[model samples]
Target: MSKAAFTSDSLESTFLAYTRVLSQYREYWDFLPFAQFDSGWSEPKVAHAMAQLTETDIEHFERDATALYQQMVVLFPEVKMLPVPELRTQTRPEVPFWLHTGIGGRKLTQIQAFVATLPTHATHSPQHENVLEWCAGKGYLGRFLAFTRNSCVTSVEIEARLCEQGLAAAQKFSLSQRFLRANVLSESATIPFSMNDRAVALHACGGLHTTLMTESVAHAIQAVHIAPCCYHLHGEGQYRPMSHVGRANDLGLSREALKFSVQGMVTGGDRIARLRQQELSWRLSYDSWRQVHTKDHLYRPLPSAPKSLFQGDFATFAQWAAQQHGLTIADTEQWQPYLAQGHKLSVQVRRIELIRHVFRRVLETWLVLDRALYLHEAGYKVQVELFCDYQVTPRNMMIHAHYLS
Candidate 1:
């Protein structure tokens, strides 16, 4: 079958773009990446550069945030011009009211989007005998498949509670679904697959989704639908590319750099945005304070704190950080200039990251392409596309691979 136009140049160009910015701002982004300025003002040179950021520059940075984002879109245009595929229109099955009893709104919407898109992807593949939901959380996606699609469903999840919950829900609905408790990372987690098995996974983080792709080939499963997320969660420090093409192009992504790929938050509401900014400001301030007394400009990642800390003034937050680190900062005023520097650095970080955002999706596609190309190399026909709008989830790219006789 002739596939719609999807090309490697997009990922290649984006990866090149990502490499350029990463190289250009290696020190700046590595230390002050993500607008959090992970490194405190310990390096005199780095601090010196930030200290020179005038108030006018900060105001300009703030004003141009939206414009910079628009410029990013123009620079790296989306190339996944996917042809509209056929979707299941038979009926929307009754979503058991109990199924959503404890699920939050965001999770529910994600589930909805996953279920809505699954059928369209599944239809494009050769008909298979069963559905295997990888890293299935309460088997929500598999449950929808079992009830709507005429297939036996097997849900695999590590959590016993989720297994129990999914099993109970399946029985209540009288659907053909079963839950398997297995640590996906273990050797024993391989699902017994036949060519008749079709698998699906939604937002499987890092190596979890990659494992599914490899297992599908190892077992010769007929089809797979996977949307990967949380690239930073991989056990390895650097991303090991999959396909030969992906491997050939040395767009090495470190764990810290991987965080930038999924850091775009254009869809969040104003309040969520403010809270995020506030959180980063306090954390940056803490870094600034630590740099002065401890003489360590290293970026120290703090543990989870009460929301009250973020609610408090910078002075109180600095004291909390000092106390937490067993350092007695007798005079917080001395660190005031450092805190001011941190804020200035945040503005600079934001502006630098706007350029990084241009390459975010394209780099993601390159990674996704590596996974797809790996599947293709393993003898499965693969298709990759944006499964939903960014509003639904920024990590919305889906990879569908099918094996035909």
Candidate 2:
């Protein structure tokens, strides 16, 4: 294998360096509900812009403000960016006509994207007798691999309904792709990987993928390709580091901080942005009202509400939110300041996020680098890269590990 683009030492150094910076500003970004504006954390221009910001500026803030992201630029001049599409290392096998017909446009795109990454992914290791698919929703990739590579595929999925569907599809094609309905997270879920096996997980969420890696090492899976998604999911309230180096690091990321790693969005359009802004602002406002009544300064995360809740004015949303938590909503005039403070806080929060945004890829890369390091420790040569463009999928990064004897 060619030299890895970033070695374990380099990835950890970048991670530890940025982790140091993030910890330095942890108090500013964490506890968003009560993150007071501190002039010390923000530079003069940043502080000034934050003060000038109002709800109206949400639409056109970037036009008037050029230096908002300047601090990030200065701090991380050589930061490794993400979302670069993976190289076409292996020429794609001709897809059967029927393979392209049944799927919807989005699913079709995802399948094709997964196909494009496989050739490059396949090049990293020796061929195996079978493929072990993890979190194999509908077994799309397994079906394709079994067809193209002529290897039996053992697909593992949590949902029986999806397993039935995927099994039916594999039967239709007469392909040797079989599904096992078992939660990859459960100890009872046996993923039968052997020396002759190569494992692939398209986009396993959080610890489900971690479980796969841990099990792959335990079972001595010869080759593996994994694309990880949803860094915040099923981490037992915080990230359980996958590698010894990661475990030893002083930077301890809470679930909230881990959520911040994936907060950078590419496909979310203006409408989604506005809705998010409104939800956050209203939550801050609700916190203010709740604080005044209960005298509790601690942050309470709100449950996900229907989109319709955010479709109305801040007051309407605030009233609904107040009722949800049994807070007695005072009359309109008294609640205005809290609502306004919420909007103001949203601006400051976004501004503070500007600094954190610089470290988004760094943190994400660190997580995956940890995975790669785990594989390395397990005696596999690992390589990490973007498997698809962010437009095809924001969850584009893939960690490929192959047992090299």
Candidate 3:
């Protein structure tokens, strides 16, 4: 199809075509099931491991944690701790007034540090400024750019609430920023053109980032900076290989791996304990539900709603659901007191932690490679580095790019 005729449907069709092409070139995409990781470990073995690893066994726990960390390193040798330079020395007072505000201060500090890493260049002319902020929820970064750089910022978002919220925030902050409510996936939502303009997206999701990359190149955006997240949520309904090496090889990237990438990008090591508990809960719930319902063995598909029903106490939820769905309640009266006491809360946290580790490694690899390839394709000088160590925050990696031409 001609580029102009490539509407949303056409774009989606093209994407599917590309997926087929990619499949033809690669073996794993065709042979392996997408939900292979969901099979999980044997329930008995998992239960045994959980029972053996009690909170009182601190020494054993420590050893296990250390071993897990080592395993993580082995699984993702490319994952590096981001270097955290002292912000006090690096932050400049005269940078911008907004830089002193709440989260803005931290963001500004990070932005300045990121800028320092990029090849220096004079800001593009301000006369015809048009900046696009991809996945700009509440226009935080866009507002900063508009106020400090004196540019007209267009914050594109999928949710109407976020667009409204962003516009309100811009008004409250007294910044010249506008929020455009549109799905990035929609072909009608094309990037506006201005010869000297720049595009910026922070933590844009997988397919959304790819859209930005395509938009930037198609529109010939003069400058762009992006930090991507949610690598598993790509256009083909799966993670697309970002590097030639990944494309050629079949490395098992689980759904948990995708979730970990999101966790690493957003949460830091501080939430490790909580994450572990979460993972345990998920495992229990999944296994318990499977045991109770013999026919429907598969985990429910990703719900088409705002929140997950699996967020609360699983046993309690299961009991409630049993009545709602007209299913016989399994007799486990001995476990009722423990369920009532919410002892499984800790397990929930552990489950999240374990799953996050799996997802983080897979997602991080995709994210790093995506940025690297996007920059390379755009003919811009780019460097990827850890913005902060995984201990401080998992989302510490920064993709710094500068237009050399």
Candidate 4:
């Protein structure tokens, strides 16, 4: 409920608070739901209460994280004292009428909100006269910025076709924009960032955004505006904290743990939910059957199958999955019992995930705040805000920083 923007000290305090709470309550969110059958609750009353959770309760928690948190507070009285910081919302951007051709409704809205949330052209110093758009897809955001601002935009993208399309659009509008087709991760990609450049990335994946941050700081870029996504997509196998504070309070985030941060169900509707449920149920069923056949209780992860596979019966999906692991489904195998068992396991997993899902945003906040603290440590005035509603995109949080030195 606090409207005050996060300063360096405040950001550190909030980050530390989340770290402490997560560390304290690691039992709830620190494990994979499918990997373990046990509820793992130490409190007898809390365990009894959670064990009684029905499908409806799981569905409710799936939709609303705050509701789950409130319920958790009621169940575990000690967690009521946990310090949870609320991110301040930014003013909604006014979307001007422009030829927003080919852009989807969701994407256009995200671009508008992102652009308006940034500092205006008048607010930029002479050093921030130029803009570098990292991983720009067709340079839509860069083109929009060029249309609205006086800054020359350099859009960097890995794909040549996208760069060509973006370049064509920029040329058509006679905007001060150009596209560079180069892998931002490659050491020899030859990016043209300078001290006068203000780096901007919209929904850049893990390594891409991290590259922008490191490159910007190294080049002494005047400013950086980034909304990062896909925390698990980084090239590095494990997470390495960027800021000193984060390193000091390291949660030892694994790839699976990072993936858990983005498993929120905000935009997906009933069909998506149904598909997800079917997929999980089938996968769990296969795992259950495999455990008995091999006499091994350890969890074995299956490679991701196509949506078409889920459309078929569990028998078909299991056969396909089994083939990949050099196993065969015997003709006499009773799939119905395993399927029933899978459904039961599915419910159990979902109930366990209900409590774990509450920390998705908290983990996300820790991530972005770590980036902000890194900028703060590098002598930048950093600010983090929710640029749009969670419904628009769960990855709506933005970090804006400018060199003060």
lDDT of candidates 1 onward, in order: 0.65, 0.68, 0.51, 0.80
Best model number under lDDT: 4
Error of 4 at 127 (Å): 10
lDDT of 2 by residue, 298-376 (tens): 6566777888888977677777777888776767447678888877776776666555555555577677777887888
What is the C-alpha lDDT profile of model 3 across 62-94, one tens digit per residue?
334435544433322222232211212232224
Worst 10 residues of 1 by lDDT: 79-88
**What shift in Å separates residue 266 of candidate 1 from its native position after superposition?**
7.4
TM-score of 2: 0.80
User: Candidate 4, clashing residue pairs?
Assistant: none
TM-score of each: 0.74, 0.80, 0.58, 0.88
By summed lDDT, the worst window of 10 consecutive residues in model 2 runs over 76-85
Top TM-score model = 4
The lDDT, on a scale of 0 to 1, for candidate 4 is 0.80
- Superposed by TM-score, candidate 2 places the C-alpha of residue 319 at a distance from the truth, in angstroms, of 3.9
Candidate with better lDDT, 1 vs 4? 4
Question: Which ranking of candidates, highest lDDT first?
Answer: 4, 2, 1, 3
Candidate 1 local Cα displacement, residue 173, angstroms: 1.6
Candidate 1 lDDT by residue in tens digits, 152-264: 88888999999999999889878788988988879543565552368889988888888888778888888888889888787867888877766776567788767766776
